[model samples]
Every structure is written in structure tokens, then in C-alpha cells.
Target chain A: MKLREQLTALLTSLAGVWIMSYAWIVLKLGSIHVPDAGFLPFLCGAALAVLGVAWLLALHWTKRKEAPAEKRLWHRPLSSLLLMIAYGWAMETLGYISSTLVFVIAWQQIVEKEKWAKTLSIAVLSTLAMYALFVHLLKVPIPSEFFLR
Target chain B: MDIFSGLLDGFAIALTATNLLFCLLGAIIGTAIGVLPGLGPAATIALLLPITYVIGTPVTAIIMMAGIFYGAMYGGSTTSILLNLPGEAASVVTCIDGYQMAKKGRAGAALGIAAIGSFVAGTLAVVGLTMFAPPLAEFALDFGPPEYFALTTLGLLLAVTLSGGSIIKGLIILLFGLILAMVGLDPISGKIRFTFGSIGLQGGFDFVTLAMGVFGLGEILYNLESTMKTEIVTTKLGKVFPTLGDWADSRWAICRGSVIGFFVGIIPGGGAVISSLASYAIEKKYSQHPEEFGQGAIQGVAGPESANNAASSSSFIPLLTLGIPGNAAIAMIFAALMIQGITPGPFLVAEHPDVFWGVIASMYVGNVMLLVLNLPLVGLWVQMLRVPYGILAPVIVLFTTIGVYSTQNQVFDIYAMLFFAAVGYLMRKLDFDPAPLPLAFVLGPLVERSLRQSLLLSGGDPAIFVSRPISGILMVIFVLLIVGQTIFFLRRKWKRRCCVPVPPETEKSL
Candidate 1:
């Protein structure tokens, strides 16, 4: 918990510094009479830096106790996140229907440990329902990389 | 136009078959999600944004969306009463006395009073909105660039107060949002700013992508971290009608909660949760049997339930009248309007009265629908809660993936959504509120435009902000808020320092 808080503060401060540098180097900072593109970003970057420093100082001063860590709390979320990424990649390669089918079935069967029949039924039903809703009804024109094009 | 005639015209648009059907659909879906834990109105709206494209007209789209907003507020109390699980943040206060009422076998009475209170307060709020929004928009028309700049500044600062954690963390997230808003083209000069020569970056990050990623996918991921095992309590509900005594105990509480909720909802960053909490506290203070609070007092359920619904309704005032969303849900609505090629601002009432008034009229219709939907059909919503999160979470991800992809058909948006989803997950873990981030991002372009234009109007004199009366007053308020917060922080730190012991060496280093 302590490590996470420190990293968050440090990363935020670094982001602030990066913003300031970008504003100075890339965007134009006009005079007060005619503020340029960089003006708002510059001010925002500076404020961020000050707030980040204040947050760090406050944390040090308070010396707050770390919250009790949960065991394996991140496991499900991480796996789910990875699945989502894979699903996105698959959508580009295999198309919406195929990708969604694979993703949902994999998630239900492997990650959630559901029965095969239930998983396949749900996966097929949801993907087809979404296909009808987005494609036929909404006319969204979602890219079909593989089968349904 | 006068309020009566305008509202009549609004009702004309709102009552159309298509509009009415969509409004009903939104209400049904909203209630289902509201009764089910782990989904919020913001995420739901973000996930369903693509449906607006099929709806054809902006008026219908907004009516449906507005129905979802207040309908969720009405349904949020269901689980709180029966299972002690707050279906949404605003319903957290309801669980205290509501679940107790269920435990004591008065669940029917509690739910009954809550429905009645919510309907009354919601109707009153819509009336208030009708009376107040047009005039506020009219007054806002007098605002120049400086006034807008000041207003957005104040809005961002107020957002910090919404966070339950460190204000500094909220501010940092807000700043990050503002920077992210700087990604594409410079509005003033067509020169590209932060694109890094990427074509996708040139259009800037799509609002739908950002909203869906941060609120929808991000929230699902965050919820996945917790192994939530809810114990469902079955309480026999004989009557769906409240007793006369229940009404007698809660009538004044409902009235007081409505008034309190309305004003709080008008303030930037003030939403259902705060208003409901405040209402509960005030109701307890005024109740003759204050000791009955948290122990199944009818007034306890009535007040906060009324207050939250009222707050949800009135929170639209800022969004419709000023183009400033008070919370994440309203921010999504604001994004919806933008997608429909309508910019919500002081001119919304004057320019797009059908969309504005139609939405307001739909709230009245939607509130009545919610009363009907929540009373006898509550069993339906409760059935929705039985769907396990394992099945629900994957479906949510699938929808999010489809929603983001469907918006512009750009795979880059999918990537962007993933990125913000991770960022949002991290922010949650680090105790940083993600609410301010989206609000800041939505307001970012407006803030930049107003500030630069204000400077241009002033010929570069920063004092132009203070020279204008409205802007000057707003700036003064902003400064006072900052100073007051600083003093409060210092006093808190001092109290903590006195309580906790520090080593001499550590103290010296400090």
C-alpha cells in the first residue's frame, strides 16, 4: 500500500514535469495580451506539480498506516483485463462475432469455471444479440475482419 | 416563451409514440441495472451510448437518457432495503434504516414510503427545474468569456470536494484530464499539438472512448477485484401501500428533503450521495423520535430516498443551463448531447428548446413511470439481482468493447479505452477519485477557449476576469473556497499531529 501511494505520487509529479516540458518546447507560449496554445497547459502543468508536491508532503507528515493488503485481489481484474485486450485484438483479426464468441466462452469456461453448455449458450446468444442490435438495428457498420463481411 | 406553453410543447414531443417507448425502455433498463449491484448510471449510459445513433432525433435520445438517470435513482433503494446492499452509492444511506425495517418485517412499508417520497420529490424537482432552468440560462447569456472561465474554474475546484479522499489526489487527476484534453488540434490555431504525427491523435481522443474506458470498463475491472458475496434476505411483503401513519411520519421529511436536495443538486459536484447524506442527518435532527433513526424509522427511509431522487433530477440544471455537468452521470449526458451535434450551454434553452424542454417533460413522465415500475414490478428488478456477476461482468465487457468500437469504427479507440480502464483501476486502488477526471476532460476545451478568449477580449490583461462583475464575484468565491480549504486542512493536520506521537529524530527531520 505504501509503495503504491509513493509510486502514484512520483508518477503524477513526473507527468506534471512532462506536461511542462511539452508546453515549453512544443507549443507556443504567447505574451499575456495574446495567450497562445501552450498557456492553459503550462498553467495546468505548474498547478499539477504544486499539488503533487503537496500530496507527497502531506503523506510524509501524516505517516498514515498502510491499509491491510488483500490476498490475490488483483488476480481476477488482471485476468479480465488481459482477456479484454485479447478480445480487442481478436476483433480486428477475427471479426466481432467470432472474437466475442471466443472471448465470452473462454471467460465463462476458464476464468469463471462455468459449465460448458452454459458457457457456449451464453457466448453464442450474447454475440448474436449484439450483432443484431449493433449491425442490423443500429446500422453501426462495425468492421468485419473475417467471417461476416 | 412562458413556462406553461413551453412545457406543453415539450410534452407534445415527449409523448410521441417513439419517444414514449424509448423512455419506457430506458426506465426499465435503468431500474434493472440500479437494482443490480456493480453497475452505475454513468457506466450504463457510456455502454449504451451507441443506441442513441439509432434513435434518430436528439430529443428522443435525451429523453431516454434522462429517464435512465432518474429511474436509476428510484430503483437504487430496492436492494438497500431488502438485502442491506446499496445498489448504488446514493442508496448507501438507505440501508441503515431500510434493512432494519426489513428485519422487523416492515419492508413493504419502508419500500412503499420510499416510492411515495421519491415520486413527490422527483415531481417537485422537475417543477423546480422547469421554473429555474430557463431563467438561469437567460442570465447565463449575459456571461462573457471571463465569466465562463471563472465558472469552469469554480466547477473544477468544487469537484475536489466530491472526493472522499485527499483533495490533492482529485486535483492531480483533474489536471491529468486537462492535459489529456490537449491531445489533438489547438482550437485557436489549426496547428496540431500532441498528436506525435499519429492520425488517430489528430482527431483527439473520442469522448465516447474516454467515457466508456474510464467509467464503463474501468468500473467493471475495479469491481472484479472484490469477491462480493451478498446474502439475500427474503422478507414477506404483504402490502405495497404505505399506512397512513407512515405517511404522517414522513410527509414533512419528504418536503424538507426535496428542498435540501434541489439546492445541493444545483451546485457543481453536489449529487445524490451528498444530498441524501445531508437529508438523513437533517431529518434525524428534526425528528421528534430521533432515537428511532437507524432502527427502521419511516422518516429515515423517506427523507434520503426523496433527497437522492430529487438531487438526481435537479443535477440536470447545471448541465442543461450552463453546459457544466455536476457529476460523472451528467458528464456522460453532456457527452451525449455533443455527439448529437448539440453543444449544451446558455443558449440550449433558446436554441434547442425541443431537446431541452422535451427532456424536462420526459422526466415528469419518467418519474410517473418509475413510480409505476417500482411499486408492483419491483419483484422484476429483484429478479435481475439474481444474475451472478460472473455472467454479468463478461457481458459488460463485451458491450463496452462493442460500444467503443461502434462509435467510430476505429480500433485505436479500443486501445484508448483499455488504457484509461487501466488508469482508472489504478486510481481506484490508490484512493484517487476518477469522477473529477471525466468532468475535467469534458470541460477542458471549454475552459481553454474561455480563458484564451477572455484574455483576447481584455487585450491580455489578466485583471479582466476581476473587472467583470459576474466573473469577479465568481473569482472571489473561488479564492475563498481555496483559502477555506487550506485552513481546514491545516487544522486537521494540527489535530492529527497533537494526537499521534512522533519520535524526536523524526520530528526534527520533519
Candidate 2:
């Protein structure tokens, strides 16, 4: 099986166990009112368990007949992933304006590799538009400290 | 005279310079986004929602957003007709005939046919909506959990049929999506089921980020690899305007698509996507030369493109009349409406005539605005495809991430989007349709909520669900569908297995 197929199987089994565990958790909480707080969760758990079981069985049946060719399905876009992580970390710390500008520029240059003129223009303009939108227009509470500093 | 009298009041509101401006702007922006790949109605609306929150009146805010959806439907065809690439998922079928006609140096004819077909379909669907909406809403007013569950079941079954592939795999994907939906906090109890302890896991996946990332970013990746290997298109650009004959030939196809689409749009879930696909299938089945369907037939583009617009327009029927969203975009509109303290259900017509009628009137105005804005703008959209894929690729991905994160300013939503993007990409690679998965995910909670509520309302008895005539009828349909499909599946498989004869022996005997 391919890595994704294996991962899917693993996830399916774990989901089954997780659901059964929830059922146990809800079942332990004894019923109080006519319709208990735990009732819905219990019902959901049952449904989830059923779904997980079916998923597992379905994957098994499909995969058994023909194992997926052992190959990487997609190229991991690492640059993009790390960029998003940096963007998140920088968002509040860098504040909306500085962070958004930095994030947009970094992606444009590193990932997109656009001409400097185009990248810089998009960075400046989009940041300004977003800034105007969130702060000046909507009156959304955005910290301007990163830019001012 | 009955509704027309009230409609005059609507025209009075919709015709206001500001409302007209908003309608035109909405359609223009919507069409622009639709023509440019990596953007869809849902994503555009979701990303732009923050702007609407700043605007006045929920109705006008919604009318503007709704305008964009239909406008995009019109503009999406520009690329599908000009280049083979579809501007949106729903317009994929259009590429077959639309680009084929374009390749044959009839680009003008193809574009003209698409535009006229969409206009006709949209108008007919609106008329259908005018006649049918209020009555349908009134009927929906009586719905409870049981009825909703039945509707959801019907939607699931139809989705499987509509999505071409192995039926079993489609069902499995849908079920998987539903289970994924269950991962977040349980609505009734507020207990987290599938949250693996991190704070990010609580809210569940946002559909927009998943859609844009997979469809947009993944598409870019695929294109980059493919473009590197293949010979690029070097055909000299030809006459851009379509001929009158193109428009006339597609009128019947457009009308048929529109009528089919409007009815399909009335359903509770994933109506627009379903409508476009169904219309294409029906059109192809009815076509004289079905062989030309996937090979660039103008009718292929005209019918499906028109159906998409018609469906997008008619989707308003469910949202306006029944207080139900047929898809996520409408769901956001429902959110905005509730924020404005305007209830959207049966009494909305009587209680909020200005909001209701004004929005309805704006749609009529918006349709005209969209066509005018889109037809001339086709040239601009086709040029977008000429931009180098490598450069445009990352920018699309970044924007999608930001858009999703902006929704709640939550990192969790970003992760949820990422996870689901992977799921979406996998589904795409495997030829499993992502359409049904989202529909299944959204409908899962509804099914659970209604079933529980029904059982509780019945004092712990399941019979209450079966007791209501409407509920019982719907349940029978659901049961019959499952039973029917199972039989059909077995028969098909059996026939395929048994129909074989040795080729060599048969040839020799002959």
C-alpha cells in the first residue's frame, strides 16, 4: 500500500478506538434529566464507531484486491508549510500590517519567485488595502504597534 | 397583480442608485473572481464576509454576495471557452465543447453561445423561483428533525449517483467526510469527540481553505509538472466575438438546463453543484452526437454553464423561503442575516418585506449587470491563464491560508483547512469527487441533531419519525433508493461478468 493508504488505515482504526472510548466516557456519566447531557454524546459515539468500522472495512476490501502502488502521491510543499507556520507566529507579534507584509513578501519571493517589482508592489498594496479595510473601514481592533515601532 | 404590486415596492428599493451600484459592483467582482482560477463563490464570499459585516442591512449585504455567485457563473465560462481550463469546478464540463469550438476558430461563437445560454437559463430559473418559492417555503415551514434527516438522506443518495465513479468508493468518501465532521465539538452536549487535545482541533475544518488549497494550489502543482512536459499552445489568437447562429442553436439547451437546474436547486443540500452536473449529463444523453460531448462540443459548454448560473440563482429559493442553506455560501448569508436580527424563514416575507423583496429585486438587476460586465471582460480573464504557473502558484496558496485564518482569527481553522486540503487532494488524485464529501460533512450534524431531537420528542420511541406522513413518505423513498441501488449494482456487475465470449473462438465460428 502507498503511504496515504497506510495512513488512512491507521487513522481509521484509531478513530474507531477513540469513538468507543467516548462512548465509555459518556456512559459513565449517569443519566440525570429526562434527556441527559450525556445522551447526545453517547449517540454520536455510536454513530462514529459505526462509521469508523465501515471505513476500516471499506479500505481493507478496496486495498486488499489491489495494493496502491508504493509511491509518493504528492510532493510535500515544505516551503509553503513553514511559511504558514512563520506567518501564524508572526501575525500577532509582528502585528497585522508588518506581519501581513512580511508574510506576503516572503511567499512571493521564496515560493512564487516573482520579479521584485511585482512582489514588492503586491506586498505594499495588499497590506495597505487590508490595513485600510480592517482598521480604517471596519474599525476592527488591530494592533498597530508592529508598524509604529 | 398579486405579487407584482409588492414587487413594485421592491423595484423602488432595488432601483435606488446605491442598491443598483452594489448589484453591479457585486456582479463585476464576482465575475472577476470567477474568471480567475483559484477563486470560487464560497471562498470569495467567505473571504469578503468581513467587508459585508461593515455594511448596512443584512439583505443588501446578501444581495451583493448573491450577485457575485451568479456573476461568477457567467464569467467562469470565459476561460472554459477560451482555454480548456475551467474557471470553476462546476464549469469543468464546459471545457469539452467550449474550448473545442474555440480551437476550431469559432471562439466568438462559443463565447456568444455560453453568454446567451446563461442569460436564458438564469431568466427561466428566476421565473420558476417566482412561481414556486413561496409555496415551497411554506411547505418547508412544517419540517422537523425527522423530515430534515430524510432530506439529508435523499441528498446523500443523489450525490452518489450524480458523482460518476465507483459508487462504493463515493459512499466511503462521504462517510469518511461525515466522520471527520463529527471530530469537533458535539453540538448538543458540547463534548469534543475527535479533538486530539490541541485547542486547534475544537472548531473543525473550514471548507473554503480546503477547497482553495486543494483545487487551487494542487491544480497549480499539477499544471506546473504537465506544462513542463507538453508542447504549449502556439495558435494565433482568432476573432473573439461569437456569432448569432451560436446563440440560436443553444437556446433550447439553455432553456432545458435552466428548467432542470431551478428544480434541482430547491433541494436542501449541494444543489448548485448537483444541478450543473445533472444538466450536463442530461444534455449529453439527449444530444444527437454524444461522442462529441467530452471533445469540445458548444452545447456541452452552453448547457452546463447555463445550468450552473440557473442553479446559483434558484438556490436563493431555499435560503429565502425555508430559512435553510443549500450550501456553505448560503450558510454564511444565514449567519449575516441572524447578526442583523433578520430571521430568514417563512414569516420573513410578511415581517421583513423590505429586506426580502429588496434582495429579490436586486437579483433581477444583478443578472443584467453581470452579463454586461462579463462578456467584455472575457479577454482579461483569458490573459490571466497566460501568467507563468510557477509564480502564480504560491500566491494563490498564501491567499487561501490568510483567508481561512481571517475567519475567526483562529490557528485551529488553518490546521483544519490543511488537514482537509490533504483529504481533498487525495480524493482528487483518486478520482473520488470532493463535492459529496462537503455535502456529507455539513449534513451529518443536521442528521444527528434531527434524529436525536426526534427520538427525544417521541419520548424515547423511534416510531414518532415514521408516524408523520411526510416523514414516512421520505423515509420510504430513502429505503427504496438504497434497495434499488443495491439491486442495480449487483445486476450490472453480474451482467458484466457473464457477457464475455472468447474473442478468438467467436471470430473463428463466424
Candidate 3:
């Protein structure tokens, strides 16, 4: 029977294997007196590999499989992941207020889709608070252009 | 007279206008983040670690940040009780009975009991912190690297107790976290660990990044996967106060929890979860109606809430005394202390009395601030529950990235955050936990430094670890912890195979 685990599970398993492989390569760098750095990562990688094996084994033992895979894409929380990446990319260029304003607006209306006035009110106030807290008060520099930046 | 004089000195520092205002701000910010779903106390402290650098006076910064810590403890139950989302580790127990209470339309009473219990616990905890802290520091002063390594091993072993559904899975995640902790440059040799030849890895994974990914972003991913499990849809119905008997019934539970939690929190590896679970079990074990535990007993909420708050406060004793943080938030506090060129240890009390007692005094003020912050703002926080994951999720990521970037002015942190986000998402998929990662990242350098120092001190003798009395005791505890958890793991696997419910692992994963 086909397994129902999501893209996340597949990625996790792949990562486990890859990290373990990297650990092996690092471990092989020397014979005796391998640095503590090498020792830790090798251990970490082995842990990952063990995890991968255990996860697969548990799935096999459980008898019941995960939910169907076809439905995974439809439920990927795509809006969230994409919007987040965009926010990160845009923040430095736009500054804190501008990017935050745009992100908040897109998030509220597009993702949350609340009424216009409420969305606008929350978006403006939150960005302003973040600005005052980080940039003005704490003196942490934030990108300041995009919104009504 | 001595106690009163000391408290008076503490109040003199805490009562200053500057400290008071900072304390209020810290409580407000801490409570805000704690109430926000997915941003646990560890991540919040980790995120704020960079900012604490900007504030003048290590004493003032520590005082204020300490406010944020227990403020979050006070804030956590609001969400768990109202939303059925265990917003913080300690609040997991709250969700069991507190959420059920909310579902049954007793959220007001549950919240009321939580606040009152937390306040009682906080007040009592300050007494414990004051009494035990100095003496503890005196004892810890004699300790050395061997003791430290043993303590770290014991701590890592206890991670098994924090396991949910699978002990092996918990240890696996912890090991991964330990390995990730190795990424930065080697402390002893100055050689890079797991940088994979990248500059980013040279510095190693910051607690902020690991915490941001594993606890904060990872939580967002988990919520996305199982939004259906949350009880927010049941009804946002709630009032703002508790009945008289509700308070009466919980008063004893709160007192018991405060005492238990204070003692437990003082122990190096024991923390809020232990207190919470222990308090809940005690309440269940001795209650007139033990059967009502999973069905939203008010005592469950009161005892656990008190225990969590007390634990959060008393943990400072260890961090300030032994230079060992009992939890991740304290670890960040340690980093903040280091940034100020201050190392917390036995002499810290005598040398940096202001930072020491200032933080101790601030807890009293912070607890009061938390109570004030929690009450009238209860409505606001519950409103936060309705903010919907879709809107809040992106903001969490955005704040995380910007926060990380703004610290170093390094654009690479954004990528690191993303990589961890992906790794975090995957860990959840494979049923791996992230709780141990921050602990590992925080303790990694300390362990690395200690191991090398021990080896150097003993002319490369590994036996040095077992040579000390303190170290030997820690080793024994470590062994017992591993053995106990192995049995637990086997029992759990047997249960899973048998299709028995495991109480949803609420309190320990607490």
C-alpha cells in the first residue's frame, strides 16, 4: 500500500541520510587524534541515521500507514511558507516598517482576509510599535522604505 | 533582620524608577510573546539575547530580562486554558484540564486560579531564591570541570524524561541537537567543528537560530499540520473571574506546588516540566476526586500553574550560582551575562551584587508586574487566540529573520534560519522533538571548554571525570536517568503496539 506521509516526512528522511553521509565524510578526515569537532558531528550524523532507520521501522511495524499522499499538496500551508520567504527577502531592502506593513496587509487581507478597516488598523499599529521598539529605542537598524515607510 | 535588610537593599534597587519601568516593559513584552502561539519562552529569550546587548547596565538588563522570563510563565497558561494550545512547555498540563474547563465554560475560573496560583508561587519562590541562592553559590564555588561535565551529562539524560510517545525519538532529536551544537569553532583548539567549510558554521548554530527554527517555526509547521486538533473552534466563550470556592479549592494545591516546584527548580536538571508534572500527579494522587484529573479539575490548573511559575523563578538560583542554566531561557540569560563581561558564579554575589540581587529583587517586582499585566490584559490575550494561524505564521517568520539579521548585520543568518526551518519541519515529520537542541547549543561550548580543560588539567586522563565526588554523584544520576528512560521507552513502545493511550504526554513534555 502507498504511504500517506507529507512532503515534510520525505524531506526529513532525505536529510537524515544526507547529514549522516556528511558525518561519515568528516569522520574520515584523520586516523587517530581526530578533532573534537569531528567527533561531535560524526556522532550527530550517526544519530540522524539512526533516527531515519527507526522512523522507517516504526512505520513498518505500525501496520496502519499515513494519510494518502495526493491530498498533501492541497494542504501544504503554501501561503504561509511563501509569504515568510518574501518577508525575509523584502525586509532588509524595504526596512522594518515598509516590509512589515506590506506583509501585515497581505497577511491580513490575503491570508486572514479580515475586514478592510480592522486589518488596516492592526497592520499600521503593529508595525509602528515594532519600529519604535527595535529601531528608535533599541537602536537596531531595520529597513524602512516599503510600506508607508 | 538580615533577610529584611537584604530585601530592603533589593527593593532599593528594584524600586528605582529606571528598574521599575524596564521591569514593566520586560513583563509586557514577555507576556506578549508568551501569549503568542508558537513562540515559547526559550525562543523569546533567545530572540531578545541580541537586544539585551543594547541596554546599559548588566544589572538593569538582567533585571528587566528576568521580568520577561517569569512574565512569560504567567502569560503561558492564558493560551493553554483558553485555546487548548500548550503555548509553553510548562503549560502543557494546563491544556489537559484548563482547556477542558474552557470547553466546559469555566475558562474564567481556570484563568483566575492560574493567575492567583502563579502569584502565590512567585511570592514564595522569591523567598526560596533568596534563602538558597547564596549558600548554593558557596557550595558550587568548589566545583570544577569534572562536576560540570557530569552535570551536563545528567541534564542530557533527563531529556529522556521529556520524551513524548517515543523515548528513542526524543534521544535522537537531542543527539541531533548536540551535533548541531558542534557546528561552531572548537573552543579548545580554535578549529571549526561542523561548518562544512562554511563561515556560518564556523560560528556554530546560535541558540536563537536553533530555538527559532525548532521551537518557534517548527511549532508553526506542527500547528499547520494539525490545526484540527486545537480546541479554538469549540467556542471562544469565557468570563474574566473565578468563583470563591474555585479559589478556595486551589489554595492548598498552589501552596503545595510552590514548595515542590521551588525545591525541584533548584536542582540542576530539574525544571518547570518536572514541577508541573509532579504537582499534577500529587494533586491527582491526593485529591478527593482523582478521576476528575483529565476532565478539567481546577486543582490541576492551579497546582501546575503554581509549579511552573515557581520553577521558572527558582531556576535562577542555579544559573546565578553555579553558572549552569537549568533551562534554555536561563542559558540565553547566561549569554547576556557573558556579553556584559560578567560571569555568574559563587563570587558573582559578592562581586556583582547589583546584578545578582538586582535580578533577584526584580523577580519580586516582575511577578507583581506579571499579575497586573495578566489580569486586565486577559481579554486582549484571549483575543490574540482568534488571530488565526494564517496571519500570525508569516509574522513569526518575518520577526525571526529580521531579529537574527539585525544582530550581526549578517545576511547569512537569514539563510541559517531558513535551513533550520526546513530541518525543523522535517524533524516534526519524523516525530523528532526539538526541546533538547537549544539545551545542547547552549551547553555545547561549556562542555567543550570543560572537557578540554579537564583533559588539560589531568594530562589527558579521561578518568578525571569520575575522580570528583560531585561528578560521581552526577554520573550516578545520569545512569539512573538513562536506565529509567529506557524502561519508559520500552513500555511506551509496548503500549503503542498495544494501542493504549499515553495520556498525550502533556506534563513532562510540559
List the global CA lDDT of all models. 0.86, 0.66, 0.73
What is the DockQ score of candidate 2, to 2 decimals?
0.22
Task: Give the clashing residue pairs of candidate 1, or none.
Answer: A33-B460
Residue B110 lDDT, candidate 2, scale 0-100 = 73
Highest DockQ against the true fold, candidate: 1
Using all chains and alpha carbons, the TM-scores for the candidates as numbered come to: 0.97, 0.83, 0.83
Sort all candidates by DockQ, best to worst. 1, 3, 2
Predicted candidate 3 versus true structure: per-residue lDDT over B1-510, tens digit per residue: 244566678788888999999899889877877787677777677666666668788888888778888888888898888777777778888988998898788887788789889988998999899988877877887888888888776776565454334555566666666667767666655665556678767777666666666666766765665535355635544555667888788889999999998988876557787899899999999999999999989999999999989988998987888776767677778777876889877778878877888788888888888887777678877777676666567556556766777768766777677667767776666555666666666676677567656766777677787778899888877878777766775676676657865443231211
Ranking by lDDT: 1, 3, 2
Task: Kindly list the per-residue Cα lDDT of model 2 for residues B332-394, writing each as its tens digit.
Answer: 565557656777777787788887778777877877776666566556656666765554555
Pairs with steric clashes in candidate 3: A4-A67, A94-A145, A95-A143, A95-A144, A96-A143, A98-A147, B89-B510, B184-B204
**Alpha-carbon RMSD of each model:** 2.8, 5.4, 4.8
Q: Which prediction has the highest lDDT against the true structure?
A: 1
Error of 2 at B403 (Å): 5.1
Ten contiguous residues minimizing lDDT sum, candidate 3 chain B: B501-510
What overall lDDT, based on C-alpha atoms, would model 1 receive against the true structure?
0.86
